[model samples]
Every structure is written in structure tokens, then in C-alpha cells.
Target: MHSKVLDRLLFKEDPVEKLQKETGKNVNDVHIDFNSGQTPQIPSQRYFQNSNIFINKHHRYSYMPAHTHDFIELNYMYSGHCRQYINDEPVALHAGNVILMDKDIVQKIDYVGESDILINILIKDDSILANVLNTLAQSTSLVTQFLVNASKVHAIHNNYILFDAQKNEVAQHLIDSLIIRGLGNDGSNAREVNLLLSLLLNELSHSIEAETHNFESGTDDLLQILQYIDQHFQTVSLAGIGRHFGYNSNYIGNKIKAETGFSFQSLVNRKRVSLAKQLLAETDYPIARIASEVGFSNASSLSKLFSKQIGYTPGVFRQRRHVLDVPRISRTLES
Candidate 1:
């Protein structure tokens, strides 16, 4: 399925060799010093430049010794299979698997098969992630946990998350778009890449939330309720939620209050506001579009609620949280 995409993006020069030549060091030499057992040279500037995101094809063979990087790494298995060691624990990865490796997570790759086609997406900055994390702060899904842990700054942690996104079209499209746009010679628009990556993360969050909802436990009623709200806060009503859960509307409200110490409407509003904030911070969509996207009836209603809840108007929020650090490129993407 992804083979055609890989073929389209394929280059004659091997990427691993390209990186090795640019750095003037073999891949193995970049890792731990045998005497010190410490990684002395971190390839902070090789994978990614000043831009927060980097995409490249993985072309390495032989056993890769355990090493850590200063940037977060997303290993997308475009085809074939391989086994990896994350923090000394073996993990088998098949085609269509995407592993999220947090910064400082010690990892080593085993010998790759001849047919393997792996793509590497490295994130060199955390500011690109702040808005995405803040938007999905309410979620407790596996993806959310991975993002939260990856965003942390502690250097002593070893963490990796596997997302079985084989059947997800949204993820596949986003990954392909990222790879294509990144390979373009239009001078590497940082803002554009960040927005595309954020959209991908947002889609992954929804995918995990849906998976969580499908496999929910009977004892975790609050979790189920929150998951429902997370996915449908844009169009969900108290009565609608009650109907889906087989309870009366008033009873549902009372149950949410009892379990979470917050009213049903309050919880819904909070989730909606979080989405609005993310759209405002990460994209250049108009206020009306954002209001509609987050489930408000109109921009006025969104404005009233946003100002009342957040102590700031939506327009002001957008201006203050604007993420395009490059002002010149901001205008280009905003159009």
C-alpha cells in the first residue's frame, strides 16, 4: 500500500550514507564511547535544522548499538519488518507500525531485512508540541500518554510507544503529505511543516480515543463518558449522551457530577474550549471556522463563552498564541 509512496519519494543516494558523509562520521561512531559508556556526540544538528521537524528515509543495516538523541523520533515502518530494542526491551515492528521514541530514550535497531522500507521523522523542538498537548490534555489514551511523556524535559527517561495504525487512512495520508511537502524545494516552510505535523498528531489522538472507547471497561464509566465527550463535544448534547449510554438526561448529568465533580455542560465546554485554543494557536483558520469546528452555534456564541471562560477574547487569544515564529512565512501559510 505505502510502497508506491516510498517509490515516489525514493532517491538514488542512500539517506544513511548522505547523513554519514555530511557529518563525516559513521553511524556507530556517533553513539556511546566504549570506555565511558556515555554518548559523547549528540547529532542535534544533523537530522533537523533550526526547523522543529525533519523527515527522511531510514537506510541503515547491521546491528545498531543502543543510542539516544536529543530530538524526538517517529519511526514509520513503510514496509517489511524488524525488531528493535528500546531501553533494553525487544519490540517487534511490522509494516504500517509507527513507533514514537521520546527524546533521550535509548534505542538500538537489529539487522534490517532486505525488503524493509523505514521512514524517520525527527522533531527537534518542543514548542511545536505545546499546543497539541494542551489541546488533548483531557485525554488519557495511550497516544496521549506517549505525547505527555515525550514532552517532558527530563534526560534520564527511556520511553517508546507503538501505534498500530495499519488500517487508519487519516494517519497514512498525513504521513505521506508530510513526507512530500518536506521533500519539496520550496525552501522548507517551517510553519507549514509544523501545522501539518500538528494535524497528524491531532488525528492520532482521535484514533486512540476511538480505540479506547471501543475497548472500555464497565467499571470505568467516567473514562467512557470522558472519551465520548472528547470525540463528540463538537456535536454532543447532554440528552444525546444520555441516550447513547442508556440513561436519562438528568441522571447522566448527576452521574457526571458525582464522578468528576463537574457538571456535564462544564465538561463539554472545557473540551470545546481546548479544541478552540488548539485551532487558534496552531492554524490560521478564521474565528468563525474555528467556532464551527469546535461545535459552537456561531462565532458570537463562541466569543461570549471563550471570553467568559478564558478571560480573553478569541481574537486576542489567536494573536497572543500565534505559533509562526517566522513572520515572513506566516503570511504565506495564512493565505
Candidate 2:
């Protein structure tokens, strides 16, 4: 299911040439950070050219050293098996198995055999996730827990979520779609990319079980709340959502705030923005129509919040190809 471009990049490119292009170093040159007695933890934003989403395939000789990223990383095992260490915990990644690792988590990839093929999908923390999670609406499962921890400062240490999709048709299809869309050189915009990613996450949430550490706690009630919000965000109120989940408004609000860092209204706004972005990118509908579709009363209201949250007016954001270029943080940690 891999694209021709992906095939060429993964198989045709010479290892030394690819390494120099990616790391800006010759094969024999040792990294200064590694030579300085510290594990090199590279930030995704820098290596990915500040793009919110980055995807690449790594071969055996291209196996990366022990490192960590400042963005969420999804390692999808397309073929063969890989041995990796996450916070020193050994993980065996078989074909069709995916591991979701959050930002700041230390990991190392051991030598991959000649037949192995693993794809790395790295997502910046604030850009696509804030909106995609709302559309996913799965707040309780192990997958949802990893996403939540990824967005927040507090993370479940030494833990990752695994999804085995070898036997699942829907999961496999979505995974393939993401890989193709992500690597294609065509004019596929960010909207389509995030949409595929959201759908992929939703599909996995339905069929796959999450593997989390003891610290990764999940609640069924939050799942109900998130699902309800996704379905009724256009018209759902705090009181109405609370009633649906058999909880009072105040109690529901507090629980949501505690679990997610977003309040009731803030969460709704995020969901609306997510929908609006999809519409803006995928359709030629008027701004007013897009606003109504995403639950906004009018275009002006939608524009106000959208600008506040995204920094660009809806029209500008769409015209710019749905790519929101937010400022990146420091890539390297101080030793």
C-alpha cells in the first residue's frame, strides 16, 4: 500500500546520502551532543522544518540513536519486527503493531534487520492535536489517554499505547491511507492529512485496546462525555451534556477540567474549530455556511473565536492551504 514516492525514498535512496540529508552530518562524524556525554533528544519541529506533521520511513542502517522528540510520535510497524526501548522499557514491535509515544519520553531504536520497515508519524503538540482530539471524542480508552497525556505537561512515564492492526481491515485501510496521503508529493493539503489522521485514530479507538501503564488512568464516564460532545457539539450545552451523562453541570465541568485541561465552553469551541477547519479545507462553501455547519450562529462569531485560537482568519487559513505555521519552541534541551 505504500506510494511509489515512498518506495523510492525508503528503498532507492542511498543510506549515506539519506543520512547526510537528514542529520546534516557525514556518516563518520560523531554528534557533538552524544560526544558530550548526553543522549541526543532531537525536537521534531526543527528536524521536520517546523511542520506540524512529519512522516518518514527509516531502514536498518538509518536506525536512529537513543533520542526523544518534543512532539507525539507514532511508530507504525509496516513490515518485519523492531526492538525499541522506551524509557528503558523494551518493546517488541511486530508487523501491524503501532506504538504511540508522547513528547519528552526517552526512546531508542535498536538495529533493524534488512527486511524491517517502520514508519514514523510525528505530530506537533499544539497544531493538529488540539482539534483532532475533539473530533475523536474518545476520552476514556488507552489511545485517548495517550493523546491526553501528550497534550498535557504531566505524562504517563515509561509507557506507550500499542494497537495491533494486522487482522483488522478498517484499521489497516486507515493506516495505509495515512501513509499514502502523508508521503504523497501532490497538492494534498493539511486538512486532508489531519482528517485522515483523525479518522485513523477514531477507527483504532473503536477496535483496538490501549496498553498503558498503571499511571495511565482512564474513566468510562469521560468517554461518554467526549462522545456526546462530538455528536452534539453543534447544539449541546453544558447542562444538556451533564444530564445525558447523569451528572450535574458543575460536577461535569470540574471533572472535564480536571481530566482535560479545557473547560466546557473551551472544549466546545475546539470541536467547532475542528469542524470548521475541515469544511474550510475540503469545500468551497461560504464562510457563513461553514460557520453554521460547525455550530456557530454566524460567520462573525466564528471568525472571532477562530482568529483568537488559530491566529488567522478562517479565509486566510484556508487560502494558506490549511497549514497553520505556529512558532516553534527551543529544539534542544540545556545540558
Candidate 3:
């Protein structure tokens, strides 16, 4: 199921058309149509599989409201002009420009123009790329290493991407050609594809430093504390966790609260709630036992908390989501 932004964008009145009407550009000649499609699940453990390229025409302001996908998405605006909000900030995108958005970011597109045509690619996040990243993180690819870690957040994550239409001929040609070659099941040499990937990162990093000067700013120490929180979601007190980086427990907890707007205990409870849902839908364990499995004190507490967060009791969520709540795996959908 999709969330609120998606529901609004797909069903509500056009926001961009209102803008055009205000500016008197809607002489009734422009036609605005919002389009959407569901992409089949792609196997990301290989090079790249089942990628799609779309070119759409929308005279009205067709918005992509904020939502996070479980994969990487890149956007290139080949023609027309637009302004977009990338992770709650206003970003101007135009012809010969591109945006590389990571999996964790929640963003929406906003633009006012005659026609907006863009190229978007969704990539699997934890596929073969994770393995490649683990290797890249430990070795001489220091810049890539920096980006690999940096790209894992809900913030405007990758600041090192800029596109200049008038300059950088090789990079421009490569971008255009990759869109063409990557669309089909043929004419793409592995060597060229690999080269394109490396060079794309290189040029993106180059431009990002110059144009996207307002990059992400925050505390790295706070981030590590958050990562520790994720690591020990089912844990408590955790004296050694803070000491691993020479931070005191109280100070670490305070930092997490300050940075992420959630107390340490609240974060842990949120994690437990998430895990509880997974267990309810994906396993056959009894409610009382599932509570202990995910570190809840008892079944009553789990039920009360899960209902508050999920808007349904564990039994109800299980029945609605899993339908059968079948004990064994069933292959219901075709690949």
C-alpha cells in the first residue's frame, strides 16, 4: 500500500495547473496528465537488471511527493525547466541536469513549465552493490568509500552531483549515451558499462563540490551513536556501547535525543514495534512468546503498544497482512 503523499498526488487536483493558471499560461492549450506505473521487482545482486527509462510529458505541475523507496533512484532532466524539493529543501533542476538520490531519502518533485521530460532509474540498494561497497569501503577508493557510507540516510544525502550543459563534453555524451544504451537488452559492453559507472561517480563528485555547497551538516559523533542504537535496539543501559568510542552513556543518550528528535528509550521502543510487525506477519509464534522474542516484557504490553503504533492488534495485523498466516512458505506470485 502507498502512503498519504502518493494518494494525494494521484487523486487530488493538479497543483502545477493552478500555478500556470495564476501566471495566465493556461490558455487552454496545455494538457496536464499525471502518469504512474508499477515496476516489477528486479534482481539487484547482479550488475543491473530490469532497469527502466521513462520520458513523460506534463504541461501542468505533476508532483512526486515525498516517499522512500527500497532502491537507488537517479533523475536527469534533459529538457524544459523545473524546481523540485529534494528532502524538504527547494532544489532547482533544468535541462542537462541530474540528481542522484539514494534509497533512504524522502523527496517530492515540483516544477512549473511547458513540458517536463526526465530520465529516472531505480536501482536495488543491497544487491551486488553492497558487496562491492564493502570491498570499496576498506580499500584505496577513499572518495567512493566516503560516498558509500554517506548515501545511507533520509537526508539530502549525495551533495557531490552537478551537471553543466555547456561544458564537460565527455561526461555529457556519456550521460546521454548511457540512457540510450541502458534502455535495451543489447549493445551495452560490460567494459563500457563499468567505465560509465566509475566515471559517473567521478564527475558527480566533481560537480557536487562546486555547486551543491550547502551539503549535509551535522555531528558525525551523533550519527555513530544512532548507528549503535540500531545495533542494540533490543539492548538496555549498554555501558560498553558508548565506551567503545569514549562517549559516556548519559551523554550518548542525550546526543541521540537531540539529533534525531527521539529519546533513546523511544527509539528502542520504535524498533521493537517494527520487529513485532515482522514477527506477526512472517512467523507463527504465539503472541506471548513473540513478545519475549523481541524483548517486550509480556504479551499484554506488546498488544497495547502494537495496537497504538500499528492501528491494529497483532492478531488483526497478522490476519490482514498475511491473509492465511500460513505456517509454511507459499509461492503465490509469479516471478
TM-score of 1: 0.55
Q: Model-by-model lDDT, in order?
A: 0.66, 0.70, 0.52
What is candidate 3's lDDT per residue for 122-180, written digit by digit as tens? 44443212222222322323234334444444344444344554355665666665554
**Could you tell me how far off, in angstroms, the CA of residue 93 lies in candidate 2 after the best superposition?**
2.7
Better of 1 and 2 by lDDT: 2
TM-score rank order? 2, 1, 3
All candidates: CA RMSD (Å): 9.8, 9.0, 14.3
In angstroms, give how far residue 13 of model 2 lies from its true place. 1.9
lDDT of 1 by residue, 1-335 (tens): 55465565553447665565466545653444734777443577665654667776766444566677777787888778888887777888887778777667777788664466677787765442343333444556555555544443432335565777788898888887777776532434655666677677766655431121112223445555666776787888889988999989999888767644457787778767767876777677788988998898789999999999879999997775554342322323332
TM-scores, one per candidate:
0.55, 0.74, 0.45
Error of 3 at 253 (Å): 1.8
Order by lDDT, highest first: 2, 1, 3
Alpha carbon lDDT at 177, candidate 2: 74
Residue 5 shift from truth in candidate 1, angstroms: 5.6
Runs with alpha carbons beyond 4 Å of true place in candidate 1: 3-5, 11-36, 39-41, 131-140, 154-156, 184-187, 206-335
lDDT of 2 by residue, 7-78 (tens): 565655556646755775435332435455677767443535534667767645545567766777888898
